[model samples]
Target: MTPPPPPCLACLLTLLLLAAAAAPPAGAICVPRNPGGHSKPGAPAKPAPPKPKPLTPAAPAPPKLTPMAPGADIVRSLCLKTDYPDLCMSAIAKQPQPQLPVGKRLDGAGVLRLAMGAVRTKAAEAKAAAGALANDPRTQPLARGPLHDCVESFDDIAYSLDQAAKSLAAGDRDTTGTMLDTVRTDVDTCDQGFEEREELTPVMAKHDAELAKLSSNCLAIATAAGLR
Candidate 1:
């Protein structure tokens, strides 16, 4: 048995034990009771990562050119030649053949008017042929040959007619008659040349019939006006 401890020492030891039990142990921090703590109530969760978007492919470009078929070219050529006949017929049909006073001689002005009308008609026909050549696929490639030839011939006829008008305007009867004859010959030659082309045979025939009627009407007018 040991001697009993002092009363003051015993009291101090009891106070030290109570303080140790109330506080946290060494090397540990005291945590407060709050919503952010481990044992707290409702809290927000972390968000998920976003998905990547898909890529789209670009579209291809269109072709630059397309080659024409053989049959298509042939058809286009025929169609182009046909246009010449149609135009020529239209010009002939629309010609104005006015009857003059009986036994009245056509003055320079009167003759010039008549020749100008004829030349205008020929120009219209030639212009139509040129347009047909430009527009028709079949005839576009061959335009330099038969189609161009037709246009050139009509141009020559128009020129001759224009000269006739000029001569008549100048009061030169002899020169006007000569120029008229030349124009008629040129038109006949053009008609013959068009007929020679196998591709233009039908068209030429149709033109010939219409041209014949026009020529006859023109001759009658010239006779009435005392131009012949």
Candidate 2:
């Protein structure tokens, strides 16, 4: 056309065209083999669920209050049978100027009878307490320890009282005083043990209190009798 292009110029032009077609131009981005490789923006990962707290258990309630019986009645009964009839009677009879003859056999016999009556009353009370404990549901378990102690104490007292009665009948003041001291000690121990337990019912408390009073009275009587 314009004077046919030079052979070398035409070849060079062809090479340039081929190179331009194969290579990417400046400012152009290249695609990866696997397209859409990157994660989308504003798509947040899920948060882990919060850990649970530990549970606590409720506290147990305290023991309930038990009602007490009238202690005065039991006290009066014990005092009348044991303290007033036996100890007080003997103490009064031992006055420097006796109303009745001091050496009278009837006086000694009467004192022995009073002592026997007191011992019998103590034994009866112990048995009755045991029976009541056996029959009562609420007090049965709690009563076992205290009731056992009370009965054992009563047994000791009864034994001592029996010995004392024998001594009194034989006019052995020394032996009688010793026996009374022993009885008083046993009864005191039983009373103290019973008082410590919180499970005592009114009736039980009354019995315990009465027994304690009896113990004190017996101790006084033993001392008055010249034992301790």
Candidate 3:
């Protein structure tokens, strides 16, 4: 048995025990009391909102392409051989392309025929114009004679073009060329007939020039194709 502590020491020991009971534990957090007299724990910090993924743009559509005509290259190659490539191209362009079976296309001879056809049509028109001028009473006497000659010359041109086409079909390239030359001569004769009288008929002259170019194109195309 030990002697009792002094009063001062006992009072000090009681005060230390009371202080320990009132104090918080080692790792405890202190929160301020709310107006309702309750101390609630703080909510966990809200997770940062997920960042929106960057938007991706869509790709643009491809451009539309124009389709090329069949045998266009072949026609262009042939036209390059002519003195009047534009005229040749224009004439051939107007012609309707035959719907050949697949794998087949226009040959040089077929293109030559198209040129010949253009010449034939032009010749017929010139003849009709000359006939019209001859029937017009307002026409001068000298012009009438030349116009009549022109009409005859165009008739011959028509016949020659026909023969040329036939000869081409027969594989007679030399005859075809000869017939083409004859058509050129007939056109020249019409021009000379008017020139002899120092006269000019605008209609006949225009026709003559167009026919000359068409005939020349035919010859060039034939030569290019090894037909002449």
Candidate 4:
């Protein structure tokens, strides 16, 4: 253009033209290929959605029972024959597990076994509860007598129920009935102890209700099994 370029300058210009021809379009951006396929460095980084929290477990449902009858359910079958069918059903169903025996049918003997087991377990629990009350520091010295008596009464009831279970096992229905009845009297005595002092506490009332239910359930079971 201005007197022909020098030889060196001419060679440089030719090289520059060749490089320009090999280049990408002027406005295009170049992105490097990733070897590991990870996300691009500055690409707005699409935020990942947060993970969901785990769900909590549900509580077990209580037993759903119809009116006691001689149909399929063994507990219902036996309880239907008792004086307090509803009470019997509720008490028996409160057990940790109420699975059927070997053949799934509860005969008179089986009824006795189940009832006696329930009675024994409840008697132990009642005795322990009463003992705790007796040992409580919150109770006044004068009011402690009734609670102590209640402890003794529950202990007596426990022993009586154990003996009754043995008599039932020995096939002595009359003796079993006698011991079970004696246990009812002991429960009343426990109540009378608190009543005499006019010191019936909330704890005592709760224990009384639970004890009454368990004892009544045992009595009803005995009646159903023809031990009364």
Candidate 5:
């Protein structure tokens, strides 16, 4: 037409038309990807955030001391007036002595009854201790003789304590005093018997010491309560 185009110019025009036809439409967008990668889409969405854990409350503190009932201190204060005040406080302070209402506080006899209950428990324990030592293989050979004496001595204490309880109930303080006095001596008698033996084990001394302490505590409680 317009003086026929040159051969080189015609060839270049043909290449431009082919490239335009192969290109994507206007408004079409493509995401760039890593070379040799397998991702299928536009930008990968961020992973969902982790859920939060539930909160827990701390536990409350425990109380340091327990409240006492009225007249609870009476037992301890009465114990302080005895010869074995230290012993009484150590043995009885932590133990609860039932408190009476204001007009009906425990009198001397009532306190003595409480002391007797404690004494009987110790007596039974002493009896069982000696019996156990006498039978135990580790202690039998070396401690048998002394343990036998201890058993008998503690048995007498138990009997006397029981009799004293009856005497106190009968309003016979004199008899109760005599019985309690014997109970105090019984512990010493056991010790003396052990010392007289050909062999003395530390076990003998140890148990006798405990028996003496228990008896002394009972005696002190009785005296403080004016049992005599």
Candidate 6:
């Protein structure tokens, strides 16, 4: 028979047996109750990534406008007096700088002269355009006769304009106005031929319209300045 164990040894063996019985099996896994909090002791957890800020909208831009030249007040005021202010503005503004009196200033009489010069150049250009259209092979058969009429009318207009210039130089405002009226009438006559024939003379019509506006401006300037 074997001898019995001592009391202390027996107690230690009892504790070891209890611990083995409470442990997990060989193939079993040990899981934590709170996996999120499972980190190294005393080590701070990484802060969650910062949220992105919302975007803001932008405002609309202002409208763009044409820039006016410095010291153009006289030109602007003169143009305002005309029936076709916009046309007057462009015509006078396009002249050579030297043609304008010192400091780009002009009295009523000077403005009248400037307006007349613009009309004279425009009339010549219109006459040439009419002649070109009349001779063009592509001109419509019905439009040809009207185009020729426009050319002849432009010739009459040129003569009238020359007379008007002479009268203006001689300080004959009444005669100048009369000649300008004739010029305007000749332009209308040319346009009338096309209208009566029901023919489209787009090129000639454009020239006629421009010439009419120039002449009208000249007449208005002449009337206003004649009072002085």
RMSD of each: 18.5, 20.5, 9.2, 12.9, 8.5, 7.6
Model 4 residue pairs with clashes = none
Q: Give the range of the ten consecutive residues with the poorest summed lDDT in model 2.
A: 69-78
Please list the residue runs of candidate 2 whose C-alpha ends up more than 4 Å from where it truly belongs after superposition.
Answer: 1-105, 199-203, 212-228
The true-structure Cα RMSD of candidate 5 reads 8.5
Weakest 10 consecutive residues, lDDT, candidate 1? 70-79
Q: List the residue pairs that clash in candidate 1.
A: 76-138, 77-138, 77-139
Q: C-alpha displacement of 71 in model 2, angstroms?
A: 32
**Which predicted model would earn the best lDDT?**
3
Model 3 residue 87 lDDT? 94
Query: Residue by residue across 1-228, what tens digits does model 5's lDDT show?
Result: 569889999999999999999999999987787554765666576677999888787788887898774444766666677666665555554445756666787666666666666666666777788888899988747568777888898889889888988998898878988888898898787787667765666465766675576666666666777776
Instruction: For candidate 2, write residues 168-213 as lDDT tens digits.
Output: 7777878877887776677666666556876665345565555555
Candidate 1 deviant stretches above 4 angstroms: 1-112, 115-119, 140-144, 204-208
- Note the clash tally of each candidate: 3, 2, 0, 0, 0, 0
Tens-digit lDDT track of model 6 for 6-121 = 99999999999999999989999766554576776556777999998887666768879778654366567767888999999788777654355557555666666667677777
Comparing 1 with 4 on TM-score, the higher-scoring candidate is 4
Scored by lDDT, model 3 comes in at 0.87
For each candidate in turn, the TM-score is: 0.43, 0.45, 0.69, 0.60, 0.61, 0.62
Winner by TM-score between candidate 6 and candidate 4: 6
Pairs with backbone N, CA or C atoms under 3 Å apart (clashes), candidate 2: 68-202, 69-202
Please list the residue runs of candidate 5 whose C-alpha ends up more than 4 Å from where it truly belongs after superposition: 1-67, 93-103, 140-142
Better by TM-score, candidate 3 or 2: 3
User: 189, model 1: CA deviation in Å?
Assistant: 2.6
**Where does candidate 4 stray beyond 4 Å?**
1-72, 94-104, 199-202
- What is the Cα-based TM-score of model 3? 0.69
